[model samples]
Target: MKTAADIIIELIEKFDVHDAGSRRAHGKGEHHKARVELNEAGKDIFGEVENAVVRLSNAATNDKVPDWLVNIKGCSVRFNHPLRPIDIIGINFPYFPFDSAAETLDVLYRIHFYLEDKSAGRFMDIFRAGGLYRDLGKILKWMPKSTDMDHLYYTAHSYGGEHYKMKLDYHPGNDRIEIYAEKDEHLIDYHPGPAVHLGSILINPHSTGKEVKYFDVLNAPPGMPPNGNLPLLRHYVYKRSFLRRMEEKLLDGKDLRMLEEVWAEEKYFVLSKSQRIYDEIRELVKKGTDMSATRFRELLDEAYALKYEEKHLRNYLQHVWGHFKDEADESEKAHYTRLSEHPDPEAVNTFIHDLAIKYKEPYILRTTMVKTRGRS
Candidate 1:
């Protein structure tokens, strides 16, 4: 039986072939480097790096990368492999800057600029602060679906002689599959969607003994394709069973209805979660509680865990907390009059409760839905 990895590989190969054909039809030949010149900032930042090449192509589709691929131009990067001795590191993006490849290049240039000045730590700080990922998510939420071939993007990084490859699979759904690999070892799989908290699965699927070991891709000698053909059948079986049991409980009428409502008003839930934290903080203020960042995070974390009851909620709660803090700070300056940053809690709660009558929308709405159903 073909594993998910095999399916992914086949999809990628199909995309490449289709893309090549499209380019030929358009009278455009593949260029070793993109035609658009990087700005001064891009040149300055990427100048120090050897063999960094960027390419813009419309071949990327919503199902394989960023869902906004239809509205935005997308690009991929190739550079020296950071952790491995491979000739190139592939950097893929499911989504890039909206409507402009130039904008995408600018963002990459900005990232490199920070990297050059302060190294990796500052680079990441700037990336997050700039709202790159958040903005991408917002755009993705509204963009039309792409009808093109699905493709995977590759980006590489290196630290302490360790090479890491990041892949974004734009499968058809609200969420994308994010894969992180170090050398030949698959490290992490991140799926972002309604059950986002249940999506982070770590695996070392190829170890012989009980001790899970990471496997390397087949790109060791250069010019060889990366290999993801690990013995994943057992791992898949275990995960399927685990998910089945979880879903049996979580997707029953009552629970499924609640989840459906949550998915429907996901935006409201995020806002309400933030507002509730602020309301609690206001009450705490009355009790002379310290409104320090530490305390704020603690309260938000507690509330999020209580409501979501999933392990991955913490990751999102942190982001929400950050937004809350910013909103609170603005409210302090009288820039906002509302006590809460979100809508009324009663209304939000009622909206969720009302969803109990509408549970037939879809039980499992995700790219992995078919795979899970097949196992059963």
Candidate 2:
């Protein structure tokens, strides 16, 4: 297989959204203009999806340094199914927390880059704040004949798993209700909360028995089946096995069991002191230099933490690989292909470039770099 970078670069060459040299538009970037104009009402939805991806990737790395990001085959197909389109988004950002509130706003800086990308105008409008409504309204009122309104989907994500839920006390007469948590009691104990809520699709990867019952309660109308049975919506859960992309699969009975294990041990340890690590990065960012002698100590501690995460991940993957090789299935084999090799910097760059093409928009890639004892 080509290195991740090679695949990413190839995708960028084919899609050509932006150039690394000048960050300038070099091709007819608005290839999917119709899709963007039509799906104006679902902008926030899309944002949510992207956010979730970022958060998941970070969690996979334990929110540490030596950061890296994930790359994939392509977006158009991964997201839209058979009719594949080249939609890829790369997220890379400093993992360290900002020193002050003002620095937090920097999170939006990458969005601006997407807004200015000529081709991305086809499906996304990063300018407006009231999400889909405000931006699409502006587009329609100003250029009524200039765009369509049908080809878009909404997405979302959560950082601490707490952000994806309802924040308001009262409903404002909106049709969108909070998707309730679901789980299988035979498998897991508590819900990881709802991480995905799209249109009518309510997905909770960490649901349990009572949670599954809860899902039925929220989705069904106030009535029992003619036979007095409850209606259950079509739902899937991850089966916790060594299969690759198992995380992407619908949560299943096995997955619930694994989640039960995760819940039991998650609080056992605070793997690393992240704040100390972040303080060092903040000093570097603010001054572009750290004058204090102790700054070196801080940097060393951060680097050590990163190395630990890298080794830990490698060890876990090694175990997973052994299990996968032992009892492989077709779906398991396919996932193995995607995770077959570890990602490197060049591969990562290509992945990000491809993501830009897939989304037809610019995105932030929060990276976690790591140095493993393996040959390229």
Q: Which candidate gets the maximum lDDT versus the true structure?
A: 1
Candidate 2 residue runs with Cα over 4 Å from true position? 1-314, 329-376
Per-candidate TM equals: 0.20, 0.19
Each prediction's RMSD over C-alphas, in Å, is 24.0, 22.1
lDDT of each: 0.31, 0.25
> What global local distance difference test value does model 2 have?
0.25
lDDT of candidate model 1 versus the reference: 0.31
lDDT of 2 at 181: 19
Clashes of each: 19, 64
